[model samples]
Target: MNLLLLEDGDFTAADQVRLSGRRLAHMQEIQQVAVGDSLRVGRINGLMGHGEVTALTSSHAELSVQLSTPPPAKLPLTLLLAMPRPKMFRRILQHCATLGVPEIILLNSYRVEKSFWQTPFLQPAVVRENLLLGLEQARDTVLPKVRIEKRFKPFVEDQLPGLINNQLALVAHPGDYPACPRGIDQPLTLAIGPEGGWIPYEVDKLIEAGMQPVQLGERILRVETAVTALLARLY
Candidate 1:
């Protein structure tokens, strides 16, 4: 883990934190930290800083921390994604956090399997666990907000218009649409569909809600790949 993330419960004092479990194991095995050694550290959804290993033992460790630096700025993007298969959903959540996506809406589409939503990975605690892994990898502290929407038409008709009202909204779909814009300076709301792509009626609904269709290329990308590619292309 690039950043040793501390939770509110980890704090023994204002400037002190106690560590155990995965973090302690990582320190003892991977980082192999010694007493008095300094390590990069950050609090969840808080500040980035350094911690000094003041005490250590087989079971736990204590660090004296000083936090001052703010976390990196999040991308000015709201991702609206058709829920992916269970097997790859965890990786996608991690990727979204690592890439600095500030908000995500897990949407439903015609092609999405109903069983995909039944995965344990969608549980609140499990989702937070994966997002934490991403934060540690990227040395970021702020967690991205994730929402799930099971009904498609209601969300598009009632809510999406307001969400995209003043934003540069686009839907990444394979067609004869314009290429995805690159390095844009405006905030965006991007919608991506399921594996076989959104059904024509769904695409029409999205267009009616204010999102213009755009294309990456002739290549059909997996949901995870499309997410990364579209975000990278946009900014």
Candidate 2:
């Protein structure tokens, strides 16, 4: 973990935090922290700073924290992603968080398996766990807002147009369309389809909802790779 993330429960006092479990193990084994040593630290949805190890033992540790620096700026983007397979869901969620996606809409597509929505990875606690790992990797504190939309047609027809209003909206699909824009300095609302890409009807519906179709080339990338590539190319 690049940044030691502390939750509200960890705080024993305004300036002090007690650590155990994975964090303590990381300190004892990976970080090998000692009394009087300082480590990078941040609070969830809060500030970034450092903590000085004041007390340590095999089971737990205590640190005094001072937070002043704000977390890195989040991308001005809202990601609408078709729910991926269970095996790849966690990694994709982490990638979204690490990439600074401020909002995520877990959408349903024709090719998406019904079982994908039932995966335990979609559980609130499990989702937060994966997001935390991503934040730690990126040294960020703010958690991205995640929403689920099971019905594709209704969401696109009723809600999407307003969501994309005044924003540069695009759908990443495999087709004969304009290339995805690069290094654009504007807020974006992007939709990425399922494994096999959006069907024609879905693409048409998205276009009607104010998104223009764009392609990343003839190569078909996996959902995770495509998400990273699209976000990187946009910002």
In order, the Cα lDDT scores of the candidates are 0.95, 0.95
Worst 10 residues of 2 by lDDT: 86-95
Lowest summed lDDT over 10 consecutive residues: which window, candidate 1? 164-173
lDDT for model 2 comes to 0.95
Tens digit of lDDT per residue, candidate 2, span 2-56?
9999999999999999999999999999988899999999999999999999999
Model 1 per-residue lDDT tens digits across residues 1-235: 8999999999999999999999999999999999999999999999999999999999899999999999999999999999999878899999999999989999999999999999999999999999999999999999999999999999999999999986789999999999999999888999999999999999999999999999999999999999999888888
Off by over 4 Å in 1: none
Q: Roughly what TM-score does model 1 have, to 2 decimal places? A: 0.99
Instruction: Evaluate residue 116 in candidate 2 and report its C-alpha lDDT on the 0 to 100 scale.
Output: 96
